[model samples]
Target: MVVAIGLEGSANKLGVGIVKDGEVLSNCRRTYITPPGEGFLPKETAQHHRKHILPLIKEALEVAKMEPQDIDLICYTKGPGMGAPLVSVAVVARTIAQLWNKPIVGVNHCIGHIEMGRAITKCDNPTVLYVSGGNTQVIAYACNRYRIFGETIDIAVGNCLDRFARLVNLSNDPSPGYNIEQAALKGKKLLPLPYSVKGMDVSFSGILSHIEEKGRPLLKSGEYTVEDLCFSLQETVFAMLVETTERAMAHTGSQEVLLVGGVACNVRLQEMMAQMVKERGGIVYATDERYCIDNGAMIAQAGALLYASTGQPTPWDETYIRQRYRTDEVEVTWR
Candidate 1:
């Protein structure tokens, strides 16, 4: 059985996990929390990762009842994240690898999420809707790659929500997106927001601008409530996402839909996708925060798969990080 330790700190979350043969033995994370109306800075986030990574590593190993020498491989998210945070995690991963004399591999963060989603849900070849603070894409397996069927032309869906939350001074604890989702639950009115979807791609910057310029002023003037804004934002953005996902499914003939990412934990989004899939006589698969949100287990899972297939680790000098590693750029050899 392959035993791997995964490190992930692509954004504000610093996670460490131990996995054996696709099973997660330990998954622990520490999120960097900022004040309301303030977003996480890349440098600050990197510092947070540096401060907590060692403790998290020790906690993970302890929880798994393993030692550094027991680990056969070390895997870390190589990119498509903030450069500083990615580098911070990479430094720790490299040090661990050298200290333990274990093999090391760099895994794509997006592919890690997709792989972990499939593993946890047992859904094979599902059309995936990946939504997070940094990305938004509709993906499906084709030609040995996680091909992007649709994507955001501007800001990602989660980023849109996060910026809106800041506009409304939402708490950063837990997550601003989660707080928005909760506020949306109490919504009684659906305010109008721009619905911008150009063919296979969607644009959220316009919507975010509109909300901030129009919605917030109205909210300040007592013409609308935060719940109304939250409700309208979720409704409009989620509808666009579902529309694109449906089109992709129809095009790809995929009967299963998989939701993966930090934002994938949204119940309303899941419910919307489920309703659409149900109409098509298909099913939707999702996981809790442990698997849906950023975590180390996913990196470990994807890295372990690649390592098991190749039986090789990247040369130590070739482990440079990629800040813009696209999902389609990764060759799906394990699949």
Candidate 2:
């Protein structure tokens, strides 16, 4: 039985997963909430990783009924994330690899999300809509690579959500997205908001700002409910995603759509995407919380497949963080 242990300390999350032959046995994650005064601090994220990574790994192994020595391969997220967090995970993975005398593979965080979506939804040849705090892209598998059909020209969708949440003072508990979703549920009015889409690319900064400026006054004056603002925001953003995804599907001739990343967990977004795909007689696949959001299981899934096919490992010295790593930069070694 071949076993793999995956580690992920990419952004503010520390994750560990144990898998065997593509089956995820245990996946553990810890989220680090950035304090109000201190913005996304890399050093703090790394500190959180240092504190939680080992325990999470151990817990995953225990849940999987395996030991560190039982792992045939070790995998860690490599780049497209915060530098310090990546380094923290890489260090732990390297240490484990050296201790167990196992080969370690560095996995791309975006591809990890894609592969995990595939694993959970069992979708083949689907156009992927990946939206997170750091990324918002429409990807499709074609000609041995995942092609980026569309992406944000500036900020990401989740970033917009977080920013809007902060504007409304909704970041005290849960997640911004979650809080927004809850607020949207009680929404009663559809406030006009900017909807910007340039060719295949989309921009949310303007819309976010518009919401803050136009809706804030109404929210303050008790003219519009917070729910209404949240509803409108979700509608505008989800519409942009649906529009871009539909365009990508048509261009790529893909009939299946897979929604991945943290934002994929949004029930409203999922519903909207599913409705859009169904209207076109296409299928939409989405993972549950386990794989929808960032986690180590997906890293292990992608890394194990890459390792099996290539027998190559990213050199420790060569590993580095890429705040903007294109999906096409790395060839898909495993289909």
Q: Per-residue CA lDDT of candidate 2, range 8-46, in tens?
A: 888887899987887999999998885432346799889
**Clashing residue pairs in candidate 1 (N, C-alpha, C atoms within 3 angstroms):** none
Q: Each candidate: what lDDT?
A: 0.94, 0.86
Model 1, poorest ten-residue lDDT window? 215-224
Question: What C-alpha lDDT, on a 0 to 100 scale, does residue 312 get in candidate 2?
Answer: 83
**For residues 1-335, what per-residue lDDT tens digits would candidate 1 score against the true structure?**
89999999999988998889989999999999999999999999999999999999999999999998899999999998999999999998999898888999999999999999998999988999999999999999998899999999999999999999999999988999999999999998888888999999999999998888898578878988999999999999999999999999999999999999999999999999999999999999999999888999999999999899888897889797999999999888777
Off by over 4 Å in 1: none
Question: Candidate 2: minimum summed lDDT over ten consecutive residues — where?
Answer: 32-41
Model 2 RMSD vs true structure: 1.5
